[model samples]
Every structure is written in C-alpha cells, then in structure tokens.
Target: MQFVQQIPGLLLLVTLLCCDSIRAQDSSNMANMTSMMANATNMTANATSPTNVTNATMVESPMPAQMPMNMTQPQQQQPSIWTTEELVTDLSLPGAPNATLDVRYNDSLQVTLGNKLTPLQASTAPTVCLRNVSVGCEPPFALLMVDPDATSRQNPQFRSWLHWIVVNVNSTEKLHEGDQAVPYNGPAPPKGSGPHRYVFLLYCQRGRRLQGSELAPEKRKNFNLAEFVNKTELGPPLAGNFFFAENP
Candidate 1:
C-alpha cells in the first residue's frame, strides 16, 4: 500500500512541473509576438512620415492630385506709354485732326512744341505745311498763336495774349499763306517776365470756306482761344506745336 501511494505522489509532482513549463512557454511566445508587432508598427510609421532617408529631415508633403498648383510665376503685361496719342494727352493738347500731321518752322528747324527758342528767332511767323495735301483730301484748317505765360511766368495777368490768328490754311501754304484774320506779331516778353510759352494750335472745319470774313480783335490781350474756336464752329485741333521764349 505504501509503495502504491508513493507512486501516485510522484506522478502528481511530474504533472505539476509539466503544467508550469507549458505556462512559461506560453508567456515567452506572447512576449516575442508583442516585440515583433512593435517593430512592424515603427517601420510603418517611418514609411508614412514626411522624412527623407538620405537627410533624415522632415519634408513637405506633395500636393494632392485634386488640388490646383501654380507652377509658373505670373507674368505682368506692360501698357503702351510712349505713343503720340499718350504724349498729346500728357501735354493737355486734346482735339481731333489729321493723323499724318507735322509742323516745321524752317527747313532745318523742326517744330516740336515745348522746345526752347530765342525770342528774336520765334518773333516771325513759322512755316506750316501738310503731309499729303496735294492728294486733295485735306480739309480747311486754321491757326491760333497764344502766350499762356504772358506778362510773367509766376503772375500771368494777361494769361493768353493772342499773337496771331488765320483761317483757310492747307498743307501747301505757310502760316502766312492763309487769310490773315489777325496779323502775325512776334513774342515780346517783358524783361524779368521769365520764359513764355508760344502755343500754335491748328484746327479743322467741315467746309473749305468761311461765310464772311471774321474780323479779329485789334488788341491781342486777353484773347479766349476756346471761345474763338467754338464760336467759329471750328472742329477739334488736329495738330499743334509750341515754343518757349524769354526776353533778352
């Protein structure tokens, strides 16, 4: 009996040891699986993150396919600033006239308004001509000479002193070639009056003739250029030129 009891105890001890071993093996296997999962998760995070392998630096993510991306810089369009039309407006010479218009005082002296000229040289009437008046498409025109800087530059008591006025002019003739509504008078800026602007404006009319001869003002002081042009029904100016003169 004693021997049989001892055999049972021995079998029981062996069974307990086997159970302990199996529990330890299961714990070890669970730990290995957990480690493997952690490593896999770390690899996935590195792949998805915005980091380059070479520099290990963070980088910006690329734009999505659905998003609009501007790859090129915007180009600015430049406006035209150096044309005859722009220059006219800049100089406050607004009117309508022949497109192919040019003015010259003498063969070598071209008239570009606002240029400087000696008082003595600009005293006489300048020569005016047309580009293609011989073609016969030219309309009747007129000319007016005024001094905006009359009396003095700082104080223009006599704002616009009319120097000359003429009508029935065409490209073929000089300013003196036209009918002398007002006889030409040279610039006579007073001493210490500073430089004066002598403006010569050309105007257009529908018909080639004036009904009756328009008498010009005897005195050239305080002449209203706008009023004269409008009252006579002269169309907008087509071309104009001017010069500056100072008393010697």
Candidate 2:
C-alpha cells in the first residue's frame, strides 16, 4: 500500500517538471518571432523612404563630376587671332576678319597672323586662296600687301610701303591672273631696326571691277588702304593674314 502511494507522488512531480520545460520552450519561440517581426518592419520602412530609395538608385560616375552641366563645355572660347594681333586698332577696321585667307608664299613658307619669318624667306609672292567662295555668286577679289611699320614701328614716317597689290580676281585660285596693281617687293627692314609687320589684306570687289592705272613708286609710300577702298568702293576686307619679318 505504501509503495503504491509513493508511486503516485513521484508521477505528479515528474508531470510538473515536464510542464515547466514546455513553457520555457514556448516563451523562447515567442521571443524569436518578435525579433524577426521587428527586423522585417525596419526593412519595410527603409524601402518606403524616399531618401533611402534615392541613395540606393544613384550610381556614382566619374565622367559626370568632370564634365559640365551639359555633356560638353560651352565651345571652349578661344581668343580671336585678329584681335590678338591688334589688327582692328592698327588698321582701323570695322570688326574682325569674316573668313580665313590662306597665304602661302612657297611650300616651305606658310603664313598666319603674328607668325615670325626672316626677310629673305618672304621674298616671293604668296599664293592667295579665298576657299570660302560662294557658289554662282562669285565676286571679284583684291589683295593689298603693306608694311605698316616702314622705317620702324616707332618712326613710321614711311608707313604702309606697298609691297604688292592685285585687283579683279574672278576665281579664287587665280590671284596671279588678276591685274597686278604693284609688283612684289621683298621686305628689307634696315639692320638694328626692330621686327616689322607685313600685312596681306583681301577685299571683296563689288559693284564694278577696278580699271586702275600704273602706280608710281613715290605714291607707294604712306599708302592709305582705307582711303583707296572707299575710293574704289571695294568695301571692307573679307579676310587677311600677317607675319612679322626682321632683318638678319
């Protein structure tokens, strides 16, 4: 009888122990679920936020930082060659040159504004080219070569010594074909004098072609290009080039 009573007590204690273990496990499982739910809620909030979304979408690129707002820089403005050479102030022209004038004396000697050349190098006549000629409406052209700094830049009493001139060129390539107003004279800057600027000017002949007379040597001294252009109604020069020459 005693043994049977003991067995019932022992069974009750065992049942209590089993119930406690199951309750602890259930509490642990509930804690884990709560943590998982908090993590999922944080992820949803981040996904919905605009700032977070933008940060995730943006891709860092090297080119964008280097380039301007527009894909290219604003034409990267360069200083006009005409203005740099002070052609406007020196010649008293209305504005900058309208077109390019290719002035090549020889295969070895090509000329641009402000280019330096020896007096002996620029001896021959240059082949002038106005390649930007309009179609059908080809106008006659004129070229005037002058030395603005005749004696010296400071003492320009013999200013604008006309070295060469041509008038009424129908074709762009046929500069030699035109009437030679003055023959080509090579630059002869006196020794000890500074560099002299020799300007090659091209004018678009409009209205009527020039029937010019033989120019005397005395008249070549102090030649006024502006006055002649106005007299002949040749209009402003379309293009021009210049080079600096100094005696050896």
Stretches of candidate 2 exceeding 4 Å from the true structure: 1-78, 132-137, 214-217
C-alpha displacement of 32 in model 2, angstroms? 43
After superposition on all C-alphas, the RMSD of every candidate to the true structure, in Å, is 9.3, 7.5
Encode model 1's per-residue lDDT on 40-91: one tens digit a residue: 9999888777664655765799976874566776888653221332433422
Model 2, residue 174: what's the lDDT? Answer: 58
So what's the TM-score on candidate 2? 0.65
Measured by TM-score, how close is model 1 to the native structure? 0.60
**lDDT of candidate 1 vs native?**
0.68
Report the C-alpha lDDT of model 2 over 89-196, residue by residue, as the tens digit.
666777777676678878557887788988878888878876755423355878788888878888888877888888877777655458887888889998877989
Worst 10-residue stretch by lDDT in candidate 1? 79-88
Error of 1 at 128 (Å): 2.3
Give each model a TM-score: 0.60, 0.65
On TM-score, the leading prediction is 2
